[model samples]
Target chain A: MKRAFGVMNQHKVMNDQDVRRALARISHEILERNKGTDDLIMVGLYTRGVTIAQRLSENIQKFEGTIVPVESLDISLYRDDVQLRIAQPIKPTTLAADISGMKVVLVDDVLFTGRSIRASMDSLQDFGRAKEIQLAVLVDRGHRELPLRADYVGKNIPTSLEEQVRVRLIETDGTDDVVIVRSGDGNNSNG
Target chain B: MTLLLSGLGMVITLMVDVESNVIGSQNVNAAGTNRKHILDVDVLSEDEILNILDQTDAMSEVLRRDIKKVPALRGRVIVTLFYEASTRTRISFEEAGKILSADVINMSSSGSSVDKGESLLNTGLTLQAMGVDVIVVRHPYSGAPNLLAKHLPKVSIINAGDGLHAHPTQALLDAYTVRSKLGSLKGLKIVIVGDVLHSRVARSAIWAFTKLGAEIVLSGPNTLMPVGLNLVDGRANVLPPVSVQPDLDDAIRGADVVMALRLQNERQNGGYLPSLREYIRRWQITKDRLSSASKEVLVMHPGPMNEGIEISTEVAHGGRSLIEEQVTNGVALRMALLYQVSAGGYQIEEEHPNGQ
Candidate 1:
């Protein structure tokens, strides 16, 4: 199966095993940076990031033997897609956590244009005064309209604007795989 | 208390939120009967609405934090004639009547004498002799409440909703909802979406919201939104008029408030909309559609939501949805209206045996 987002031209073709390794690495980095999960939180961007954050929290629970709080956000109201195409987007859920004086990491599936991240950052402002906020993503696609970047990234895939990146996972797509796709025009192809 | 006898039922209630022109200014009875936008906030200045809501809040406390009863309106009898089947609005006035210690009588015409071809006029005249204080009425006809209010004397009329004409109580709850969320209604960009033509809440909301100095944008498919109803009796008014928008996204863009009225399926039969799927695809408050507005935008709906159809389940349940708050505010708003109409005229009596 193909990743929901196709044609991610990162360093190499990552299988499900490679994706798992990347998550573990990212999880370890989050654990090390925060020192401990004492006052730290992981917030996911609606549908996909929710799973990513939950998986990372589970990984952290293995060593700490305690669960870290993870919150899911439905940024439909804060999405950048209002005037654009009509898509039945997912609604996000949030957990009531006192975010003050805590480390917050906002997770998303893809980082394209960075507009979504900017919106997510704005959405979190209403919840409370957070001491610190960080952004993490699986793939950082570089055609950013907004001057935003992820603090933790699984991979940076630089590709033509037209190329689509697909990240497939068993938890979602029933298979684990990642690939970049052509524009089907034959002239514009991702190797 | 001075009682005026009439052929129709008489109702006694408090008077609140009555906006008359500049103090001592004369009302020149216009050329023809004018239709006032009861929900527009602009007709009433911001201060007026703020004052009303503040008063409404105080009146609300009487019904909410108390023992569900008030001596403020004792010795009053009000007839609740619900021509439509509804749970929320019907019970609100009933509760308001009982709370104020008024004799509450309900007449649902399903198996009543109305089925025997008795006109509304005859039933109203018959109820008049019963010595009622007020008539809280809901009728399917657009001008039924106003007609009843005109023909009847002694009894004040509280319009729960009159067809697609105006649902004043619902509008009051909407005003309460916006006030609860924003703490104020002045100078906000409020957009109303979905079936504007058939939704009385939309019509009433326009009046109440406009009265509070908020800008209103009526947005929906051209077929669903009938643009020319903002005037008093369909003529121009002193208030700022409602702006029309065919595109939902543009209407919601940078909007401070977005209220989605339910899409009535019956209008489609009258060439009002193309299809429900098309309407949802184009106008439903989708996730992406929400981001067009500023972060502070509020999403509201009068409940029994269509879920994924009119509004997505996610957005409806999301943090922005004020649906529950709207329902909660309904009881208090109706109570406030009742308090005003029922007890407004009740001045505390001083100890003067000869005054009576």
Candidate 2:
């Protein structure tokens, strides 16, 4: 209980160095599993995931000496949990790209219950199809209700279900960090 | 408005299948019956209307939450010339034109040269000379819109209900009305009752319904039915499908819809009918008539209805009536037509040879 309290506090929040180390490990794993980067395509579910996919593609290109195409998706309409809460999530507009006969790797910052990844599939159909699609996340906290498991997971942090994960990136927030807050964070709180 | 619409919408008209080689545009087949609006009963059918609706859905996305303006009809001029009077129909065109950024000139017979008996042909020619690309006309003379269209080589004529002729836009909206209510126009039995002879809405509805695969049985009094007139053919303005008995009971037997057209008692001036009582008893759309028909039948009319004369107020306001939807669709459809006709001319990256 004491160790969990230390991890949940602000002092142990992931910084830029932690994010770089995690992405470097993800880049090597993604290239290794797919055998090479030539047949791979990375598409991030917007908005933050879009930046993550681009950086992951760039990192993979640098480490493995091959290019991996990147795309971004917007999935506001295809969510099942939207009516359960009044959160009006304005999905970022997706970039135009035809994804036919290619493999797509959908990326996100955090995968908790894995529902967002399923909703992303519904949004992806408005565009064309690909041979296969895989999931890649930076943080995977396993309290999942849906049958979604990431192919490339950077960190597996098991915590109480009340804890909420917040991912902040410099491209969007002028800072890079992944922190957990309790039910009283006031932002991600149900209260 | 020079509207450069991307060819994205493709709504196929029902009976007018894609394989059918028949189309009745004014330029192509003179043997056509009503070439003015009936492009194809099947092929070049309402797929274009459906496409327009689809493109409209797409364009609405572009409009986002901002002021609804696209650089669609930027440099073009659309002239709204009406010899008669209208509030809903007239404003629909104006609003549609303004949204697409077209300069609109509203001309009425009350003030314009129409009072001096200026020919629709001469006025069309004058508008054509003024670089007007499209003409939306509502004249009291049946087929005057088409006659004006015949003279204007460069201008596309949109028939906003000609005098006792046919209202193509009204029919398009009616089709949209059915599409919205029932989700599709396939094999829907729409029995159009009242003023079949005189309602331009009826003529346009017949052509469009046949195109959309909605089987229709036009029913009304003998004096009101305008049959054997040489109207424009849709499939090359080919011959109109045949005129039969205008019996209301037989028409409504198994219909999926009953569209009641208004009775123009003012136009009749007590000459066409013996009495309003007789007209209502013979042609009025009642709940009983509807009840005897299909349970899921829809009731519709293009407004200014004769309460007990053509249809009971109960039926008009009661059930299955898409009367209000028709008016709303009129705005959307006319917006679509104006958007398609005028918005793309100035924005043309390549010259279209069809630019006569």
Best by TM-score: 2
TM-score of chain A of each: 0.84, 0.84
**Candidate 2 local Cα displacement, residue B272, angstroms:** 2.9
- Per-residue lDDT of candidate 2, residues B55-167 (tens digit): 43433343342345433455668888898878888988887777656788898878778678887788888888988877888888766765665566567677787765667
- Give stretches of model 1 more than 4 Å off: A1-191, B1-48, B63-66, B228-239, B344-356
DockQ of each: 0.01, 0.02
Q: Top DockQ: which candidate number?
A: 2
- Candidate 2 scores an iRMS of 18.3
lDDT of each: 0.66, 0.66
How far residue B241's Cα lies from its native spot in candidate 1, in Å, is: 1.7
**Residue B192's lDDT in candidate 1:** 90
What does the i-RMS of model 1 come to? 20.7
Worst 10 residues of 2 chain A by lDDT: A82-91
Query: Can you write out model 1's per-residue Cα lDDT over A1-191, one digit (the tens) per residue?
Result: 26554454232357778778778888888888888787788998766677788888898898677678898875533454422322222242454535667789998877787776776776676566688888887777688887777888887777667676666657877876655665543211211
Chain B structural similarity (TM-score) per candidate: 0.80, 0.78
